[model samples]
Target: MKNIYTLFICLFLASFTNAQDKFLTKNGTITFFSKSPMENIEAENNQVLSIVATKTGQMAISILMKSFMFEKALMQEHFNENYVESDTYPKATFKGRILSFDKITATESATKVKGELTIHGKTKEIVIEAQAKRTDDAIVMSGSFFIDLADFGIEIPSVVKNNIAKKIEVSFNFDHKPYKK
Candidate 1:
């Protein structure tokens, strides 16, 4: 009887561990805003793929460069052709993990995520104050932060330098389902 009870406890713990190991998102959005005195530009990528594997502490996120839609066509063209060079660098990706997962509680609503963001082939360390909420069948992670264009090798033309903000606000809303594999 004792052995059977121990086995039941182990199975329960194992199920929880498996539940926390993976996350999937089918409707994820990443949005950014660059405000200037002359004009404010806002863009968003609705089809974003993000995965967070808690067991390995591995995270991978990617967004198609062309997915970013701007209100102004000219601005969008220039962004792809010049600053971002979307033709060559077609995707933005980040490969990192949460620094301290052991200290995080499964039922907690918010936690600090410390990881690295790679954009334009440059990696930068970023700490995001994020919130993780668990639903009936999914886990949602959301966060907002700012990044400097220069830090990612994105250059602004001197002619329009003042027209763009140096730092841009970025926000992420991800609805993640459990990964089976």
Candidate 2:
């Protein structure tokens, strides 16, 4: 009986070690664009972390608010300090599932991704169109979505309201590899 129990435990652990059904990445990229008449703001961060369950079509992504880099140092500072309140909210995250997981293959496929995005301590449901290419070695997923600053509890100063757009465009590229034990 003890041997049978040990066998059951070993099988359970071995099942989790299989990497083919899961994919993960540590250095995905996320970019945000805010275009206004006064100025066009653009920032990119390559330190995103993401994971995907191929069988379940479930995915999650995390990005550090402070990691986003802007062309101007002042813009970066203002983004973190005033806009996003990076001190209070250090990270932004998204948790959702890919709609057409089975359709993902070595060829690129278009699909809709639905998930909840959290930023600046607020969360909102979002659906966006995405392109995905799955190869034997990796899965690449890319998408763009628009968000309203007010929806995420982010406020722009009235003095520079024209410098920022009320709706920001956010895009991401994630290349995930099979998880290994």
Candidate 3:
């Protein structure tokens, strides 16, 4: 009877030690900027949920399409209905890993996180130089990267072709908390 009890305790502790480290945030923000000769356009979504599973070196992020807001309502509507077609494709996701997880140290510094980003129903590999810092109880990650609209099948009308830059800059600011299983 004592042997069985000891085995149970050992198994429990082993499972706990092997559990993955997770962090979650719903108030994260993802913003984009597009520069054109005619005008500059910017949009942002604050309801982004991101999770980092450290043990597996896996990270995932999801953002609601309708959460993206623009300065003009018409632009916002068009972005969802015409451009993104949010009704059909409601979220954008990325499921990848930090290529060099072993090289990362628990300190305030910048690291390159390479992963695959899925946007508009298409997946593309991207490398982003992200700044990371370990706070009191959370890990804060921020970075800015560029993406070409055409790469994701986002069509640009000829009338406004010159106004928007080919490459759009995307920025992310996330505060993640440890996820306990």
Candidate 4:
């Protein structure tokens, strides 16, 4: 029927338009490093989920705390059970908007992204400087930032006080392809 054909056409167009307005990636990378007088520690997680809304320059990211792998198995175990308490706080999240986002092109540009970062059940407002690029098919973002452990109520025990740094350096990268349903 003519009505059925029109309805199908409308649905197709809607999806097509939506694909252009949003980008997503399931395997983004997030790494963190801590330096102390005793030693340096690092961990990486590749199972990060991120989304970008091209229309509003808004972005959201979700990272599983347990997904982070450390160089040593004991360190990883301590991180989940002693430090981050992964059982109680399983995920870290970020929701933010990109400033001067419309200026990004196929060429990488320095952009400011402001957002709320939630970790260990605590939230903090943060502004990060990131390199961002946008093309017809994809959006790429990479950046490094520092976070204070005390801000999130993650207390370091005195037994290993010299083993961890107060501030941790975090790096992230996400290449998002156009989202399609």
Candidate 5:
């Protein structure tokens, strides 16, 4: 009877250790900026879902297109109905790995990430330079990258093309806690 009890305790401990290697959060934030000579546009979304596997350096992020908020309702409507077609493609996602995973320690470190970004039903490979810091309870990751609007099948109207930049700057920040279950 004692031997069986010991075995159960060991198994439980092992499972708990493995759970510490993964982190997740459902309220990450992602922001985008478009700056041109004519105008500057910006939007932010705080309903981003993200996960990081520390043991393998794998990461995934998902954000609802409609979650992005703009200062102007007209701009938001145009962005959803025409630019992004949010009804058809409701989400954007990124799946990739952090390079040199083993070197990431508790201190803040600079790293490179190679991943595939999917937006508007199109996928493209992208590399981003990011900063990662392991806190006492969470791993905070932040980065910015530029993406061409045309590459994602996002077309701007000719009349307003000058108002939008050809390339958009996107930045993200995620504080991931150990995922339970």
Candidate 6:
């Protein structure tokens, strides 16, 4: 996801220049779980790209739909080809700002971030609760939220309707370091 990093850096750089005002992570982690009566599906993607603008407490994240690694190959194939249609819509993105921008410090605290989240070609405005910590050299954020499939217009076939949960639990962790030239 070098291109994602480059693209995000360019987007953020175009607006600001101070390295300390920007924090970046090329290897953030995101995981999703779908619990069903018949089966439980889980996948993890460690190649998440994220950028945080400390000056404004603005954050942006990008995840490739196909980057998720499932335990079963068939599940991954079905997820890409049928569920998410990764070829048609390859990326899920979030652009948001921390509510208590000035309160973030070395001590972690419960925080609220509001922004637009887009997946499968659908965009929804959401507010997510997260624990945020900021220090001189690093900023860390972690949180979990649930999303309804219908909101994204992701349809599950009747045949496999019972195999997947209607609501998926998504979790994310991003550790950002100070940017430099």
Q: Pick the candidate with the highest TM-score.
A: 6
Q: Rank the candidates by TM-score, best first.
A: 6, 4, 2, 5, 3, 1
lDDT top scorer: 6
Q: Residue 124 CA error for candidate 1 (Å)?
A: 1.1
Q: What C-alpha lDDT values do all the predictions have?
A: 0.75, 0.85, 0.76, 0.88, 0.84, 0.92
User: Which residue pairs in candidate 4 have backbone atoms (N, alpha carbon, C) closer than 3 angstroms, thus clashing?
Assistant: none
Tens-digit lDDT string for candidate 3 (1-181): 3353344334433433443356667679999999877888899999887766566556677777888989999889878987778888777877667555545566868777778888788889988888886544777789999999888888878876897788999999998887555
Better model by lDDT: candidate 2 vs candidate 6: 6
The lDDT ranking, best first, is: 6, 4, 2, 5, 3, 1
Q: Write the per-residue lDDT of candidate 4 for residues 1-181, one digit (tens) a residue.
A: 3353344334433543576688888789999999999989999999888878888788888788999999999999999999999999988889889888889999999999999999999999999999999998999999999999999999999999999999999999999998776
RMSD of 3: 9.2
Each prediction's total of clashing residue pairs, residues at least 3 apart in sequence or on different chains, is 0, 0, 2, 0, 0, 0
Candidate 1 lDDT, 1-181, residue by residue in tens: 3353344334433544575567766458999999899999899888777766666545667777788889989988988998889888877776666555545444756666776787777789888887776554666678899999999999998999988999999999888787664
Return the lDDT, model 2, position 92: 89
Cα displacement (angstroms), candidate 3, residue 161, comes to 1.4
Residues 83-166 of candidate 5 have per-residue lDDT tens digits of 999999988888889999778777889999899999999999999999998754888889899999999999988999899999
lDDT of 6 at 175: 95
Candidate that beats the other on lDDT, 2 or 3, i.e. the better one: 2
Return whichever of 3 and 5 wins on lDDT.
5
Q: Model 2's lDDT to the true fold? A: 0.85
Segments of candidate 5 deviating more than 4 angstroms? 1-18
Please give the lDDT score for candidate 3: 0.76
Estimate candidate 1's RMSD in Å. Answer: 10.2
Between 1 and 4, whose TM-score is larger? 4
Model 1's TM-score against the true structure: 0.80
Models 1 onward score TM values of 0.80, 0.89, 0.83, 0.90, 0.88, 0.96
